[model samples]
Target: MNVRKFIAATARDALRKVRETLGPDAIILSNRGIPGGVEIMAVAARDMELIVSPRDSVRPPGGTDAPAGGAAPELTRGADRAATRPAEATLRKPASSWRPDAEVPLPAATARPLTDAPPGGEGTSAAAGAAVVPAAVMDEIRSLRRIVEQQLAGFAWGEVARSEPVKTEILRQMLGAGFSPRFARELLAELPRELDAAQALAWVRGRAERGMLTIDGESDIVDQGGIYALVGPTGVGKTTTAAKLAARCVLRHGARKLALVTTDGYRIGAHEQLRIYGRILGVPVLLARDAKDLRATLHDLRHTHMVLIDTMGMSQRDRMVGEQVAMFRDSDVRTLLLLAATGRGDTLDDVVRAYSGLGLAGCILTKVDEAASLAASLDVVIRHELRLYYVSNGQRVPEDLHLPNRPYLLHRAFKDLPESSPHRLAGVEPGLMMAGGGEGMLSVGGQRG
Candidate 1:
């Protein structure tokens, strides 16, 4: 059974992708549009077996609950006759009498629609797999699908989640912890049937831990040498995060090995805030008023082990973000996005999409202390394949920011779960951290083979 999510620029393109990944038998479960394109959720025909049995499979002849053949019930006899009628008819027609172009009527429920049929024409022939409904008919079908998917997106998710106990429990935990319902559904769509509830949850938690990239770099990134800049939407704590990074680098490598630069002349005292932190940490702070100044500053700071740039905060809607990204890209600066965990999942998704072209060097999670749930932030990181280098929960210089062990963070996601709740997932077990983890969070400039 295989369930997958696909995104593309158009319905046609997305459906084509669905066919390629999930095969011709894929059933589209849901779809909706986002910032730049469409998102479609589909399950392969085999995956649909989880919901319904195969049509060709038979479960013993006759009604098994019946008496030992006192007599087959009348309804049962009728069903048996109906089932064999088609085969009887086919056998009665000799091959020599069959016409090549003759159209045989078929039951509408079992009939395969003809492909390439003219608009409004009756279906006359069947293609290999697709029902070649008229273009207008297809359009109407797709439109109806979209409507149903949209309506079903929010309503009645519980009924689907309740199909199986283990998955239901896992879904309860995930939803309670603030994970998106779509994300929760996809995660547990293919649970192993053999495992008990505890083992299943352990596997799920282990899976989530593995998907998150937790690095071992000294203080996340400052230990490794690089010219980097923190970029994100306003109020995500980019400047504060920059200061925290600078402080960490200063502690390990000393003030002499690092430099602080700011390109935030737009905000009154933006540079001043970093400058104050620089003074406390005894690191030099420079201001780059524009891209020209930024390039010049990078040239001078080339001798430093790590140059941490604090760029101005702007809404993702601003054009300045692209300009800043351009500056960082041209100067060989690794850009790190500061994400606010407190923000809504959709906003986080939007921010990641808006800044994705920056060639992000991983992410720094901020405001973990404030967010009611980290699900949205984590979801964005995992879905976008963004590397998470560090997390900050407070304003205590380098003290609040550090790289968390993947298991520790994964455990924290489920820490507040109720013990008596139907979904009692005991945090991600420790041993599985290594056995089931390590698929994400690459170090700067590193790629998984």
Candidate 2:
């Protein structure tokens, strides 16, 4: 048997060369890809007759007949000629007729050896038989590891450690808006490494999950024939929201079937402002001084399909907070808490707590167009588990207020920001920094710090 190793630019070409030089009977011992292409090792039994053939002209056909000193020169010349010949042409030649009776020598086995050895030999022999990974493959793996380490070393992992709170706050807000924790984590993980303020905001918007709000499938408003109050803190557009609903009811049930009621008797021009809306919509406006007056007004409008109650904006700390809640207690009326999208987090919380006594049927989110983070308002709303009834974006009656749709609300929560608002790291407040074990903070780059 004879063994040979071959290297070529590709695996296919190397295999072709082996077959040509070693004949069709050659056995492939090993083949593998290397940096340059492929390497193949093969073995073939020597054709003894071919060795003595005229083409070789090395040993005499009669075997060992030539003087030992003369044989060396002839053998060296034959080897040189064989090396110089084209591999394909050599492989095309016919086998020599001078066959030898002696057995051919066996080539050393190139197969990966077994590592499992009988008991005592395990330690030393098994180690020796272990398969060796090629040097080229080892080098490639090392190079990849180095590249990853270098890239990671340049990142500011320390900043991420400090900003964990901010990321948590962002995640908390997302969760409060009805996003699942798993979905939030997956999305936040993909945030970019660097961002400006506008970019960070954009990243937050992009990473937020959709479908945060739930909508009532029934399109028609329930006809519970008593005063339905719109109560909330200052500047939440209650007056406008009431007008929009009044218009909708009138459009569906006729002007005579609807009435407008104002319990905001304290605010200057509150009655007069609603009066103006009443005149245009052609619905009657009634002024209620107290809960007793409210009940009386309800009785007067008994024929009405809907009666919209607009209350004066009150501070959460105002002594009148409970008074307003009392106004709806004994009446056969539904109450709604109105919230402004532009209001602060704490302020929204106060409003919700103040209105808790009224048995709020649902909530109306107003001034969405003016808010920087609508999710903040939504966070408060969903936390209380209040059904969202309507959303008002502008002052336009009937046109601006829309029946809140869950999918639409989710889209708003996670929609991408305009190109003008990129995320940035500068001007971030120190208080915004996340404390250890607190909620994670989303950085301007969309990454949790």
Candidate 3:
């Protein structure tokens, strides 16, 4: 087998070299990142053919060929050991000689992440030394190219500022509200083709409200009550939100109807803090360290009308979130992911994606009053299709939490407007927006999908 190594400053350049030197039918054995650049292993298809096949019609790995008028090959310990032998032996064969699959080992690509494979890859290594096909590598390359194009297609605001001052100002308002650039650009793209300045915002405000989802028609979470567990990253006001839900339950029904259970055993004095709130509300607080403990605790509090579980604080990046989510499998509990409105749009998007897969009932947006703009968090909620159950603006127990109002949110988007707004759009002439080759135009069809 003739193996060659190609090194370049980038994967693309290295791959180009492999194609030029080894021809189109070069098999890539492995690739790795080094201090200066990337390293790729390649060999010509003909060379690989000599090494991988013992006969003209080569037998596939882990399979056997039948001789004429003979029974299937008998299984034996000796045959099994030969089948599992290392690939190094096949590679170390006498120069320019063919070998069987018995000595070939699995390719290194199988051990690395899917992304570590060659860019324009198709199909796996055939019999250890077979060259990878273009079909496999091109699939990943196409995907990467699409992503790059999408990012480069973002709204070029700097060029837009040269003309169309009115449309530019509308974009300014969207960004000022703390919405993500991708989301803000998509929203503006959906506007009417010939819309005037006055009509532009009215169109967007209506679209945003319709996009919002909710658990019940009203914001009252108790309307569809069950075992509710508040799960999210640290410092999103899960405890306070849980307390507020308990307070509402207590006010609507009596103390006997509400029960507070906490699984926050990690933080120091965490259970103690929940117990203090339990004392204030005159409700019992229970602790559960593991899945079994949680099941037992809920079983003991089975008679209670509403059980609010205050979960421990954890980073969304932690793998334990999957374990924590799985704990509710044995029990009948609905998950409510808590989010902070002050969070960045990208962070909120990641948080929602991480928690949304757990069959969440909905989400509660907290610290709205502290957020410079609610668009950041709201954009993520709308994009992920997660329903908004409640919004918290203050520290007050039950008073701060309220149902989401579309009209109120729309009003807030355009709040504190300058008096010159009406006159701003009066000066721009027609066709000025298209002056810069139309690249500055918002991609009207690019919605949150």
Per-model CA lDDT versus the true structure:
0.62, 0.58, 0.63
The CA lDDT at 39 in model 3 is 78
> Please, what are the lDDT tens digits per residue for candidate 1 over residues 1-449?
56689998654467678777766656666777666767877776555334422221222233233233212222233333333222232222321222223323322333323333323222121111122212343344345443433332222222223334465556556766766555654566566756778887788777777777767864456777788889898888988888888887888899999999988888676688888998999999999988788888888888899998888888987888788777776778888898998988878888888888888888989999997667777877877888888889998887898786677666666544667865443432211111112221111011211
Q: What lDDT tens digits, residue by residue, belong to model 2 across residues 15-124?
A: 56877888764545555546765677766534322322333333334343333333233343343333222222222321111111222221122132433322333322
Task: State the local distance difference test value for candidate 1.
Answer: 0.62
Give the distance in Å from residue 216's predicted Cα in candidate 3 to where it truly belongs: 5.5
What is residue 121's positional error in candidate 3, in angstroms?
34
- Per-candidate alpha-carbon RMSD to the true structure: 18.1, 25.5, 15.9
lDDT of 3 at 194: 67
Query: lDDT of model 1 at residue 112?
Result: 29
Candidate 1 backbone overlaps, count: 2
